[model samples]
Target: LVVRLPLYIHLIHSHIHTFSFSYILGPMLSYFNFALVSASINIFFFIAFLFQPESPYYYLMRNDVDNASKALSWLLKADEDETDKELELMRKSVEEDRQKKAGWKDLVATPTDRKALLIRFLIGFVRQFCGIIPISCYSTQTLKAAGDSFIISPDNCTIIMGIMMVI
Candidate 1:
């Protein structure tokens, strides 16, 4: 797990970076360039996943507690007793989670849940159909229409947007 931490962080960073770039710089980039960048990121993620270590939680689920304990000790630099206790707590949490069977239909069955669900869905739908993409894609043309000459480079804009997201 320790060895795979960097890969996990990379995966998370790539996802947030991609979304930020899409949302903030999509219009500035040519569609072809955007596709190329997206493909490159995907390939990087594939390679990272290829070398990532398997989770100890998965091993425990398969009744391989000895191997799971060893993995935990390696990641935590802790004794076997401490690792066993930690793993036991995790097993309990998984059991509790499994006992709670909440589904989408249940959300809609309750009035309060249904209202919350609808509002969340509406927000997501509105965001997807917003004109931000078109505005960004034709940013130069839009500026020209306004008789302006200023241009916003996508890379700089994306970095700024990524910082905002992190904050």
Candidate 2:
């Protein structure tokens, strides 16, 4: 839930911005209406954070089992006993995984795993540095050069590129 809610809100904001820009900004922009749209999205997210529930997983990781149990009970509408049992299971699973002692060296020690890791790392680095942003920027410029009006401004274009990097 900790990772999911922000992504959900971001998806909502992106959809809103895309629709607003395509329909509204494409026709208007007399006085920085795009800025207003951005501001409204920010305000909506701020309000959402005010009402967002705390994550049980985060509390559990912090070793605050009481708060974690309360959070789980609130989220699941379950009894304390059930919540405690679930939390204990989750904790055991995590500990078991940790006891496996997986690390970079484990992968490097195996030829096939080492090759896979190297390939994955190379692909990730190439995608981050070369693939996505340049393609998007080129496409945007091509569209602009062809006199195809776009609601996606250069700033938003850069922001989208940044988001791809972070993701």
Candidate 3:
């Protein structure tokens, strides 16, 4: 989880720079580069995922025995036929999960789960309302519009924001 923070910081830092640079491009095509860059990255990731295999559990639930066996074999580093026991266990687990109705309904059904959901919902709610997203998205334009801080480039303002975010 600690390592996850750095990754998020890096991604948000990229967003800061991308939009900061957009301000330099002025209002006409302000977000063009950022959109292009973001889209290209997303397309690359999408294509990468296209090559990846579907989850074994998904195939098993669909009753695609052949594909489920193959996926299980790949996951367990064993031959497809060797996964019979694993598949049987997965079948049992899936049946149990279905019997328990362990889906979105369960997320808020019980007292403990409801509390967990409330805590998570509040955390996400606070995160967005705490100014991080807007700051990263428009801190450059905000600095530019402020007029008094005209000496520091919008790009530099983004760097300062990024540093503050990391710290």
TM-score of each candidate structure, all chains considered together = 0.62, 0.52, 0.61
lDDT of 3 by residue, 61-126 (tens): 787878977877776787645678888888787778777755678678889988999998998999
Query: What are the lDDT figures for the candidates, one per model?
Result: 0.69, 0.66, 0.71
Q: Report the alpha-carbon TM-score of model 3 versus the true structure.
A: 0.61
Q: How many clashes would you count in candidate 3?
A: 0
Residue-wise C-alpha lDDT for candidate 2, range 100-124, written one tens digit per residue: 9887688789889889999999988
**Model 1 off-target regions past 4 Å?**
1-16, 19-34, 144-146, 149-167
| Residue 9, model 1, lDDT | 88
RMSD of each: 5.2, 7.2, 6.4
Q: How far is candidate 3 from the true structure (C-alpha RMSD, Å)?
A: 6.4
TM-score of 2: 0.52
| Model 2: colliding residue pairs | none
Query: Which candidate leads in TM-score?
Result: 1
